[model samples]
Structures are given as C-alpha cells and as structure tokens.
Target: MTRQFTGCLLSRQWRDVAGGVAIDLWFATAEEPLCAHVTGEQSVFFLSADQWPQAEVLLAGERGFTSSEPGLRDFSRRPVRALYFPAHRQAREAARRLLEAGLEPLEADLNPADRYLMERFITGAATLEGTVERAGGHLVMRSPRLRPADYRPALRIASIDIETAMAGLELYSIAVHGTGPGGAEERRVFLRGPGTGQAEVQAFPTDREVLTAFLTWLAAFDPDVITGWNVINFDLRFLQRLADRLGVPLKLGRDGRPPHWRPLDDDGERHALQVTGRLVIDGPEWLRAAFYRFESFALDNVAKELLGEGKLLHGPERGEEIGRLFREDRERLVDYNLRDCELVSWILEKTGLIQFCLARSNLTGLAADRSGGSVAAFDFLYLPRLHRRGFVAPVAASTAPDAPGGFVLDSRPGLYRHVLVLDFKSLYPSIIRTFNIDPLGLVLAADPALPEGASVPGFRGVRFAREGHLLPDLIERLWAQRDAAKAADDAPLSQAIKIIMNAFYGVLGSPGCRFFDPRLATSITLRGHEILNRTRDRIEAAGHTVIYGDTDSVFVWIEEAEDDPAAEAVGRELERTLNAWWRETLAAEFSVESRLELEFETHYRRFLMPTVRGSEKGSKKRYAGLVADDNGDDRLVFKGLENVRSDWTRLARQVQEELYGRIFRDEPWQDWLRAEVAAVRAGERDDQLVYRKRLRRRLDDYQRNVPPHVQAARLAV
Candidate 1:
C-alpha cells in the first residue's frame, strides 16, 4: 500500500493489523502500544488487538467465517474472482436476505451494480469476524474495529474521471478533491491523456507508457479517498486493461491492489464499490441515495445543484468540448476535470455521507449497501451479547397505523368552511428552538435548577445537552426561528430555512450521515410522537380537530357558519380565531411556540382520514379524500397509502396517484387503466419506466440474472 494515513500507528511501529479491505491482520504482542488515550485511531492500536477484545467482539458478531472452497488449491494463485461465492449465489442470497428483513430488494444486476454489491458483501462480511469478538461473543478474529472515523483517511481527497481515444489506447485527465471539513487543504486538478490538438502541462508523452509515469507523480498528495462519476465503470477499467496489455504494473497505489466494486441485480438497480485501504466515494450513487432528484445525475446537473458553479462544460457540449480541450488545450481540460472533482467534493462537504455510513455500520450492524439483515451475523455475535446485558430490540415496527392514530378529523374538497393549517415551518428545528433542544445545548441548557440532570420533559430517557451534542442545538435554533417566522409570515425565509432544517434530520437519520445516532433519531421521532399526540389532545378539547399532518404541516377544521352573505366573513374570522387559540393555548400550556397559523392552502370539501385500510382502526400515514385545490382541480390524494412507498414500482406510484386524483374529482379512470395495462402486457410500456438505482462501480460485473429494468438500462449503454 502507498503511504496512507493511520491515526496512530506510525510506519515504524513494527506491528501488523488483523483486518483489511477484504481481509487484513496485524500482530503486535506489546502489552501497551503507543498513543492509546486519543479519542479514535489513537485508541485503536494502543489498546492492542488482544486487549480490546470487547470492541472486536462487537464487529465480529455480525460476520461469519467464509467456508473455504474445495478444489481451489493454491488460493493465492487463483483468479481474484474465483475466491469467494459466485456472482449468482451472492445476488440470490442478497435478495433473499433483503426480503426477509422486509426491505424490498431490487432484482438482477448489471456490471456496476454487481461489482459494487460484491464489494459491499465482501467487505461487509469480513468485519463479521471482528464484530463477533467485540460484542462479547467468540474470538472469531483479533483486529481493530474498522470504525469510519478512524477509517476517514483525509478530509480532502480527489475524484478522477477520464475520456480516452482509440479504444482504451490513450491517456486522459483526472479530478481530485477532499470532501468534508478541512476542505481548504484539498485541491482539485487533473492530468491530460494524449489526444488530438492538445498542448502539454509538460512535454507530450507518447503511448500509454509515458502517461503511467505522469500518474506516478500525481500519486504523491496521498489522498484520503479518490472518487468519480462513472470512473470505475469506464475510466479505471480502461486504465487497468490498457496497463495490463502493455506488460507494466499499474502501480497507482492507494489501496493494496485494484479496488473492488459490484454491479446491480437484474432490472438494473445500481453500482457500488470499496477500495481496500482507501475510501472510494462515488459522486453519482451517493447523491441519489441522498435524495437528490433530477432528470439526470450527470456531472453538470448534480455539481450545479450542489455548488453554485459547476464545470464550464454543459450537456451536449461536454463531449466535444472535453475532447477538443484534450486534443487542443490540455490546461483547460485539466481545469475542467479538476472543477468536476471540486463540484463533487463541495457537495459531499455539505452532505455528511461518509460520516453517516460509518455511524450506520456502527449502530444497526447494516452496511450502507445491505438490502438484507445479516441474521446469522446478528444472532450469533450480537443478539446474545445484548440480551445478556438486559437489552432487547423490539421487532421491526409495523408500517401500518394503529387505532386512534394521529388523524382524527373528517374533511372534503371545497372552500374550507374554515381551515387553519398549523405548520412548523421546520417543525423539528422549531421544536429545537422552542424547547431549546440540542446535543451540546442540552448540557448548557441543563438546569442547575433541577437536580440529577433530569431528562427533558415529555422525552423518554434523553438527558439534555452533554459533552458531545450538536444536532440537538441545531434543531433547536431552527425550530425557534421557524416559530417566529410563522408568527410574522416570513414565507420565503421560512421555506428556505425549513427545507434545510428538515434535511438535517434526514441526513442524521441516514446511516450515511456522520451524526447517525439511533438515540438522536429516537430522541427526535419518539419525542415528536409524544409532542404531537399531546398537541392533538389539546386541539380536540378546544373543539377543533387535527385533520391531517405529514412531518410538518397540520391541517385543521374550525367551525365557521354564518348567514349566506356573511359566510365568507365568518370563515375568515374563524381562521383568525383558531390561529390565536392555538398560539396561546400551546404557549401557556406546553411552552412550545405554536406555529399553528392558518394557511389558505386548499379548500377541501370532503376528506377521509381513513381507518388503516383493512382495519377500521385509526390511520397514521395513510388517507384519501377530496381537495378543491386553488388550481380548480379536485384532487383525492392518498396518505399512508401502501402504493407510493419505495418497495412499490414506478408503475404503482403512477397508478395510485392518478387513480385517486381522478376518483376524488369523479373523473373516468376505466379507459386509462385499460389502455395502460394493455400496453404493459403488449410490452409497449417497457420504455415507460426503468429502475436505475444509483451506485458507483464498473459496468461489467453484471452477467447472469437479467430483470427487465436491468435490460432497459443496458439499452442506455
């Protein structure tokens, strides 16, 4: 491995480690290693592999020993692909595991998807040995826990992409960046490949041989992670193939050897990868999983949305412009490639993806790419240990709602007799503010007035700000500001702030977020459930009702009946009265700023907060009713509906959304369904929607299973 960052273990430490990207082990029999007191990496080696068996147990508890394959003598001499399970077996097992865990798994795989998946499983399973040891289980392996924080090589890294000529025969440019904090230290740059009409950063080099020398020089910065858009699928593969044909070692060493990646299953899911020693963050895949929605997650679009500026190259212009720059102007081409890396890096800085992945793996024993639970890994190494300690996890909660659920009012489509919408312009943030909720703030805000550092009221077991709490305080400030904003109708500012505020919780919830703490998420959601239920009760006592709510908005009905001529006047008065009532009642009672202002969002003549679809019980996230939107269309939308969820297909979302919209408006649907289904059966609708999961990996590894969506993706290729 090229000189990489190790938090504490100096190159001179003369010790070996037990874990690697696929498998690594270091042996140091010293009773006390150096630098043990540090928070993370400093702690790993000093504690010694044998001494910190507790930590090792936590990790090993999740993975099992790979049964050695028979007739595979001279393992080191076998092809890298021949080592573990076959592609089809891995894919099938992945699907089975996901289904068992209640996560709807995507079918089949393509090149990138398969490679990334394999990488995911391989690296994922390797850790099971250590986790098994750390969790107070058996001594499956002796090594340091591959905690993400310790694994973070550098805050500043680079992403390289290339466009070549003559079918993988020539050189091209590369991009570099460092994503997280301490970004200033990182630089984005690229080198040019030989092509038509290009000037040299240095003198021109002929053949792929000279280009390899340049890559060696570029390798010095010692990047923490190197990423790309589709560099693995297209660029790296080409480079490797080119180098191999030339009889030279492609020693652009970051990881011990070439990185491993997997393609998606049939029906074209996505791609993912894992560099052995180095972290390889893929821009396209990470952005999609982060919920960045756009027509295309191309370099330009994502970069523009993330950074204020993107590559000068635009849609159609990218190819000709890049090719020309490579052939004609090498410097600009390098600059363009570098700029692309910067764009990706900047977005990642703002979005804590790497942090989340680490936190997630640490928390629930799930890989970011894991669609299925590591049941054997969990049961053998984890559950027993936790059970012994008087801790037992509840089964996965039913997604369906319970009786007397959140929704309690009846409504319809029309001009609201009087509708008051209570919106927490950023509910969680507002709550943070109103209640002064923050991780760090919890400690500061903790009342010396109260003894024993009591937990926040209405919160179950969450002590206020402690030595290391940031999100709580962040949520608090935003929450408070949102309350004040709602009181004054700062619509634009509120919306912007609200979007960011809501997003914070999401990022935090994601395992990919660095701040991923189940406690933090639990603190927010469980408390939210507590607070919301109480708020509803208060509203009901006042004779108004919470008709519907999703995350932040609370729909309400306030009676306002008057003589025909004064009907409009009465409606306005009722809205005003209810708004005032909510603000005062909540403030005097709960001390939470009631962001309950009536928004003239829509006039629902009729709305049904359905009983959980199959049961006559109250529903939580599902409902369907009529709304006369301002656009003059009466829409009957579904809430807590099963059809619009992630497991459902694009077809399902479309069918449900349209069906309800037409149903509420009392429009004809028979013809539409007939035509659509017929077209689908005739294979005419094949092109309508193709599931393209976002991942970063090569495009070849997908060979066997072929789902329709994956086939559609192949068409794009």
Candidate 2:
C-alpha cells in the first residue's frame, strides 16, 4: 500500500548503484525519522545545438549516456540539447571530455542531488508518497515521489563539548546535553577515570573506554543536530584524530556511518564535517550567519551576552584549570564540561537560532545548517523559474563590468534641531517590483519580436520586458509574506524573508551568480541614483532643507517645527506627499505602477552631521542624534562614530558619547571635557586607554609601515 507523509529533509547523498545512481534522502517527520531511496534519475547537462556535432563525435563510444533535445535555450537564444547519463560520474567525465575538446558545457558543475531538488522547487521540506517498509528504528521509502511542502521538524539537538589536555592530545571527558523532540531530557558526562558517585557522571578506566561509551550513548540518543562552540573544527576534529589513534570508528551518523571530513580551503586549517542523517552546526558560525554581531565569539562571552550566564570556568587559564580539575577534581571537571555543553544549548535556545536556520532553509532551499551560500540560494530560486520560461542561465561569467553602487548625496554639515529622517522602505526591492527588472525580462525585452509597449527602457542601453518576468513577482510574494510574518509576530520568519529579499539585488550584481549581468545591476542602482536625486530636489523645493541622504534614507531639517511631535508630523506629510508623487510620476513617465513607499522612520530633536575629522568637507556616513523616547527620556544614537565603533578605545568612545550627549542637550560641557582630559592625563583612566582591535592577519605577515595594533601584536608575539 502507498502512503503519503510530510517530512523535513535533513540530509541528502547519492551513490552509484548497480544500474544507476540512487539518491538517499533522510527526513525527520513528525512521527519518526525515515530514509527515501530515489533511483532511475539521470544526471543531465545542456549543450548548444551548434556544438552537439563535435560533442557527439567525442562521446560516440561512451556507454550509459544518451543525448536528446529538451526544448531549452541558452541565454544567447541558441537552442540547447540535454546530455543524460545514468550516473553522475559518467556525466562529469563526458563533460570533461567535451571541455577538453574546446566545447562549452552548460550547468555541468551542478550536483545531481541538488539538481533533483532545485528542478522540483523543493527546499528543506517535502511531501513524500511511496511504499514504506520499517527498518529497525526507522523506515525506508522506496522510490518515493517528492514535492515541495511547508514542514518544520521538531529536531532533537545535542550540545556536546569535550575537555582535553592543554596540548589537545589527551581526552579527559566528553559532555552531552540533549533537548527537543525526545521526551526525556539527557545530561551526561563520560570521563576517562574511575567512576564518580554523581548520577550524571560516568567514568571509564581508559580513554578508549570513555570514547566508546560516549559514542554508544550518542547513537542511542540519536540527536538530529549536534551543536557546540567551534564544534566541528575543535571538538569533532580532535575526536576524529583520537578515534583514529585508538583504532575505533567515530560513527556519528544515524546509519552508523563515520562523518566525512573535508578541508574547506587550501590552508587546511578549517574543515567541514558531513554526517549522514544529521546536521553538525557550530554555534558561532550559525549565529554570525544570522547577523549576530559580538565583540568576541568565545563560548563564555556569547553565553554571557545572550543568556546572562557564562561557563563555570573562564579566562586564558581555562585550559590549565581544566587539567588541574581532571587530576585532582574529576567531579568538578565533569561539572565544568557539562556546564559548557549546557551553555551552548542555552545560547541556541535564547537566540532561537535553530528556528532561524529552518526559516532560512525554507526560504532559500539551502541546507538548514549551511551558511553563506547567497549565490547558491539564488540559483535554487531562479533556475527553476528560468527553465519554465523556456530558458537556461549561462554559467557564471569569469569577468564582468563593475556595477556602480548606491548614491550618497553630498551633506550640508551642521548641528541642527528638529531633524526628521525619512526612509524608502525596502528601496531596491520596491524598485525591482516597479521596474520589472529580471534576467529573463532583460533578455526577452531585447528581442525585436517583442511588442514595443511590452518593453521598458533600462540603463546602459538595455530594456526589460514588462511582463513574464520572475523576480518582480517573486519579490512581491516575499514582501507579502514578510508583512504577514510581521503581523503574526514571527520575528525569525520575518528576518529570514528580509535577508533573502534584500539579497536579490546583490546576487544579480555579483559576477559569481549565473544570472549576473551588468545591465541588470546598473538598472537598479542607476535608477536609485535618479530617484534619490529627484527626491532631494523635491524636498528642497518644498522649503525644507535636506542636510544629508545616504542610499535609502534622507535627513531633513524641519525649521518650522519646534518639538519632536511637530517634526514627526511634518515628516508624515512629506512621506505621504512623496509616495503619492512617485505613484503618479512613475505611471505618467514610465507607464508603470510604482511600488515605491517612503516612510517617516524617526524624529530626532537634535542632530549633528559632522565634518571630516581634519577637513571642512562634510562627512558622508558619520553622524549622531538625540531621540526622545515615549517616556520623555533622551537617548543618544551614534553611527560611524567612535562611540559605536568596535576598534576605538573605551576612553575615546566614552568621551565622545558624553560630549555628544551634553552638546545635544545644550548642557555645560567645557568644564566636563577639561576634567575628563585631566583625569586621563593623570593616569586615572589608564584602564580605558587600551585599544581593543582584532588582528585580521598573522603578526609576521605585517611588512610595510604597519598600523599601531599590528605593531603591538608583533611585539607581544
């Protein structure tokens, strides 16, 4: 009997079977974990019909390969034919032969497993329909039919941390804290020593025994996600090395398969771990990907910042402390190790990072654990749409013309009161929606066969099709979803949609993306340039003074307004006026409806647009403002200033904040500044004088005239 179920895709892999390649997809459903075996799928790539003659001769004797016309055309409008192979290896080999023979192959580098999902528009969630057979603890689906579905799995997460000797050669203990999905909570530590009387602590006589026990417990618990601070590079890598020395397999996968470890770069200092049916996510990596910024990514620091608690032990001497605890205080060592594991779990829970990851995956069709694949995500969303439009994208260009960036209006520097900030909501996305900017649109618009009114003029002598474009409609859909997410108070989903929607412009602008074209990027940015300039002119004509404008926001001095509410009222009027003007103007001029929306974002009672540090010229991005809260309390906000910069010394930042606050509030500041300088000169503020900066390169790599921080680093080394 056939069964239908929805499951969230956890992992995917492909293997060469007897007759063809079989894609093994593991999923976490509401009921249980399951594996689906999809066979009889061919690995395919496309080639220009004109080049098929030479390609046919090159692959004439190749077995298990066939060629056919699939009614697809390349970006250059040339008819393309698909080359199919029973296995990925065979297809890759044929593509290599064709390349060596000086024939270009299209979409040859795409992974077969990724292609299967992308073509079906399947992201992380899918609905499966097929025959199911129960295995020991899981089920196996044979040749399931899969389609995209909205599903969020309740995954079991294990936060694991290992304590080793200072040199990292000897393992002392391994701690595991499991949460979610499973009914029972798990907190256990396996230490390499005599058993402790504590219920959560288990001790073994040898390192191998401890490792074996930990592995056994882990396999039994079966977490879908294994997380910790730098877990992949430090904990997992150390365990793999120790396991190799102890002649034991590090079976971390649900299928009892060892993780596949691969170096990420030529340096080999960093590695990526792939476990079958499980995700190994490092806490810091995913946090950064979610746009969390911190002074440091140390587990203790992050835990303190996010959870208001930190590790049991902290500081540079933590390693030594662990060692001492291992020899003299095993129980304390176990507690410390377990605390670290718990801290990782707490951090993840506090930030809702797992939910954010799932939301991002649902939007981008990327692996939930994957980070920094904006280009890949773009491909996943765009390629299928392009295919349906009867076109295939060209490979990423090796080189493309650099596109101009956003327009920053020249500032009229001054300290002023009642300055209101107006912002264009999602400016680039709104422009995309208004202009129908798309790769397929750009290509189709250039065809003379297209009707005259169906095309709109773009920058750099390019045109865009008014209809049959995908990006505009896609953005519209996401924009509506984001609105709904906001209304429902789902911050993670809203943030995910925002990040993906904002990434569309950058993806088109980047040469790394297959759909990248200079015309497409410039059309958006140059149009923005036009919009900003015109908006500035209109604002100035309305008797308000425009002090500064950067990219999407404009600062206006409302001279007629005396208080914050009055300034905000003026801002609201301007917003409505400009929005209506844009709608009418775009419809009249470009014969298109405008999605442009200008919003009154903030009202600053006092604002400062500072000049260059040593010049009278107005600075572009540096500014400060005082905003009054609803409670009638004034708060100082800084941008591109020392008070907000991470590299600046605390002394400078504190002084700047105090000085700015006093100046904005019209309070006495001269006496305070003199006293502060005197205190600093007298060594009273010496602790605040130390500059905290991160070194981006090795100390020895600094050659030429080095910066002060680099010099200090070299001296310390």
Q: Against the hidden reference, what TM-scores do the models get? A: 0.43, 0.97
Q: Clashing residue pairs in candidate 2, if any?
A: none
Compared with the true structure, what per-residue lDDT tens digits does model 1 show for residues 52-108? 234233324223212222222110122111112233334345434534654332212
By lDDT, the best candidate is 2
Task: List the candidate 1 regions with Cα displacement exceeding 4 Å.
Answer: 1-154, 165-171, 177-207, 241-255, 266-271, 291-296, 329-331, 350-387, 390-411, 414-538, 550-553, 557-717
Q: How well does candidate 1 match the true structure, expressed as C-alpha RMSD? A: 16.0
C-alpha positional error of residue 433 in candidate 2 after TM-score superposition, expressed in Å: 1.1
Summarize candidate 2's per-residue lDDT along 187-270 as a digit string, tens digits: 999988887798998888898999999999988888889999999999999999999999999999888989988898787778
- The CA lDDT of each predicted structure is 0.45, 0.90
The lDDT of model 1 is 0.45
